[model samples]
Target: MKMNKNYCFIYSLFFFVVSMFFFLFGISIGFKSMIYILEWELINLNSSSVCFSMLLDFKSMIFMSFVLFISCMIIFYSNLYMNLDYNKNRFIILVVLFVFSMMFLIISPNLMSILLGWDGLGLTSYCLVIYYQNSKSYSAGMLTILMNRVGDVCMLMSIAWMLNFGSWNYLFFYYNENLSLELNMIVFLVLLSAMTKSAQIPFSSWLPAAMAAPTPVSALVHSSTLVTAGVYLLIRFSNLIFMAEMNNYLLMIGCLTMFMAGIGANFEFDLKKIIALSTLSQLGFMMSTIGLGFPDLAFFHLLTHALFKALLFMCAGVFIHNLNNLQDIRGMGCLVNQMPFISICFNFSNLALCGMPFLAGFYSKDLILELSLMMYMNKFIFILFFMSVGLTVMYTFRLIYYTMSMDFNYNSYFILNDEELQFIIPMFFMVLMSIFGGSFLGWMMIDIPELIIMSSWSKYFVLMIMLIGGWIGFELSNLNLLMNSLYLTNKKLVFFIGNMWFMPYLSTYMMNYYFLIVGNKIFKSADSGWLEEMGSQGMKKIFDVMFKKNQNFQDVEFFIYLVSFFMWIMILFFLIIFKM
Candidate 1:
């Protein structure tokens, strides 16, 4: 225990120091508009060379710095969160490894090196997700890893496709004006890979399921860093996506993901899952922003979102810990009375999530929405965007009402308070970031002021939608028995929207069940039945009959008698001829 505590402090300080250094370096790089590439040749073949390379620019350095910083905080927080657990040392090690994997991914411009980090993330996340050593954790881990494998496969295909260009370094092609048709296909594959990683649409089931992990892991991995990897990848390849003319498709998917996750969160009861859905919605927002030809805005939102979301999860961790691991929001109410400081922090982060004015989320989110409104898009996209925005606020309001306003529904023996410095200290830093990170990041990221032209009605549209959404959320939270029955009368509708449009079912039981049925039929009709008889079994029977016939011909007595009789016949014939 002493040793583990030492390890935690040591790593925490190490990561914190390194993170500050990287942040300063990133700022300098950005100001100077500098890029540094370091490469070492691993293997050289005819006309193709594989080299390990790192791209050190403002983007990579800043992202790496943020990841490490969050990692440092989460590690310090975990020292208290996982104190009673037997394998806290192992937990800390896995987290450190996960951070390193993310760092590798952020810096690598080569697909091969990217794969190393990509696979590292997948593997470490699986280990972390299953760290609880139980059936639920095991199931969640399996689902998480399997869903992620789809993206890994897509990434591998893209890597192989890049081999056609005689190099796997994607940095060379990032700014290529005259790209070939094959490059488009590679970009398409890369897009699919990013979608799966980011949990867009059909691949989104795994994010909520990943709540099986410990809350610190949830804070660091799921909410902030791990889920954003796909968005980061797409941001890097934004130029390629535009060149391939796939931005519209990406835009469509991103919008749908936003809408779907937003709706799901409004109906979700699990505390962690609601937050997970929120993360998904924000990821979609990032994707859509990138799709609209604004990677800078997306990156801006990504960084800000990371700060608040991590804080949100950290506050949630304290709640769950105090409640004895009860994560159902229905059982929590008036928590502010017991834990005032945490409640304040939680509310601040929540409001930040809703893009409240002057908060971290507002600077990025409002800018993205306004800029998107400036773009010429169809009615479907426009409606989806607004609806998604409304739903986000609706869910946030609903969550706050259920957990903070209603009467406490848990056992009276519960002991909840804001006394843990380990938890509060990390969350406090994030709270500071959540309050001011966006404006600071905006200044650094946006080199030029964007010209957003719109009418008064258009300008006020977001505020109007948010007001309406908040009202609906309040009304829904106060639903009477009659209203509940009327609203939930169509259980099927509730089920569909509430479960991410049945993505988990499709990804798991629905898809797997059909394939298993086909496989079972094939096994029964062929392998165990007809094929068994006609294949090896029938061949064995034919061989048996041939063996029996050969046995008769090879009888020793029969062969000797036949030879003697033939010899006597030849002798008699010769004697008769001689007598004549």
Candidate 2:
């Protein structure tokens, strides 16, 4: 126990100091060109060499600083969260590896080195997902790794194709856009890889299923770094993919993912899954913002979202731990009274998620909406953007109503409290950041507001959407306002929305079902049927029949052998006499 605490403290301090140093370093590098680590080569392949290279610019340093800071706080929080577990050391070590991989990804300018970090995240995250040692954890871990492997393979393909460009160091081309034909395909492959990592559309089922992981792992993977990896990659390569056909496809897909996740979150019963869907929704939102040529805005939302979402997961972890692993929100009620402090933090985080004014989400989401409207685009995109934004509020309000309606659905000895020192210490910092992150990030990121200026009614459009969304959420939650049979009335629609439109089934079954069926058929035909008849089994049977036939000829065979031996002796004796 002492060893655990000591390790945690030492790691936390080291990360904290590193974060500060990076932040100071980033501030000092005002408007300078990117600095590369060009000291030595890590590998050589004939004319081309793989080198140990890093890119230190404002973007990387700032992002790295924030990632490290969150990791520092989370590690400290884990010291308390994992105090009872004997495998706490293993958990801590995995987390360290996980965070280190993320940092490596942030700084790497070479595709090969970035792949090292990318594959490391997939591997460590799989281990972390299955840390619970249960059947559910195993399945979830397999799903997580398989989904991420798509991205890994895509990245490897990109690296292979990049060899045509002579150098894997992409910093020179990053500022421009493309290198040529081969490099353009590399850009396309990178986008596809990011989509899987970011949980966009068809690749999205794995994020919710990943809830089988420990909530702390969820906090890290879903909230801040891992899920956003795709968007970050897009942002990093924003110049290359701009205005391409694939870029437009990505924008549309991102919008659809947002809409789907919003509806799914409203219908989700499990607290963690609801939050996971929300993360999916927000990832779509960020990707769409990048699509709209506002990657800086997407990045702003990404950072702000990370702060509040991490806090939200930490609070969810607290709730799950206290409720004895009961995650169904239907059984939860009266949290406002039982856990007032937690209720406050939950409300704060949820409000931020809903884009409440002056909160973290507002700073980014508001601009995205205004930009969507201001852009001379068609009506379809505008509606999708607003609908997605409204759904964010609707689901958030539904979650709040379910948890705080003063009804005590759970009849157990369990009691929820926010008094634990472990809970309070980590949460306090996140709570403070959730409160101030938007304004701070806004001041730093946006030089010119460029907010849309339209009719008076247009300025309040975002507010109107939130208000209407909240009202619908209220009606949905209140039993007195609607009949209980409403769900049955729209059964098909409810199921489609409630089950995320069967996306999980499609992603899982559609991918493996046909392949498994064909594989089984081949196995039966080759191994069990025709091959057995043609192989050693059939050969042994034929030899046995021949031996039986030979037994009938045993006496005749002996006579022939005796005659042949006499003839050989006579021939030899005659030859010896002739020689003499």
Best by lDDT: 1
Q: Candidate 2's residue-wise lDDT over 1-580, tens digit each? A: 9999998889889999999999888767734545646536877887688887787887788888888888887888888878888999999999999999898888888888889888888999999999999999998889889999999999999989877767787765654345467767888889989998898988888999999988888888876678977888888888778734456777788899999999889878899999999999999999888887888888889989988998898888877787878899988878888888778888899999988899988888888887777777657877987898899999888888888874878766766677887678778888898999899878866767674777778879989999999888867887633635767688888888888878777777866777767778888998887788788778888988998889868978999999999999999999999999
Tell me the lDDT of model 1 at 380.
96
- lDDT for each residue of candidate 1 in 105-146, tens digit (9 for 90 to 100): 999999999998899999999999999999999999999999
Determine which window of 10 residues in candidate 1 has minimal summed lDDT. 173-182
Clash pairs, model 2 backbone: none
Query: Lowest-scoring 10 consecutive residues by lDDT in candidate 2?
Result: 30-39
Identify the runs in model 1 with alpha carbons over 4 angstroms from their true place.
Answer: 174-179, 480-483, 519-580
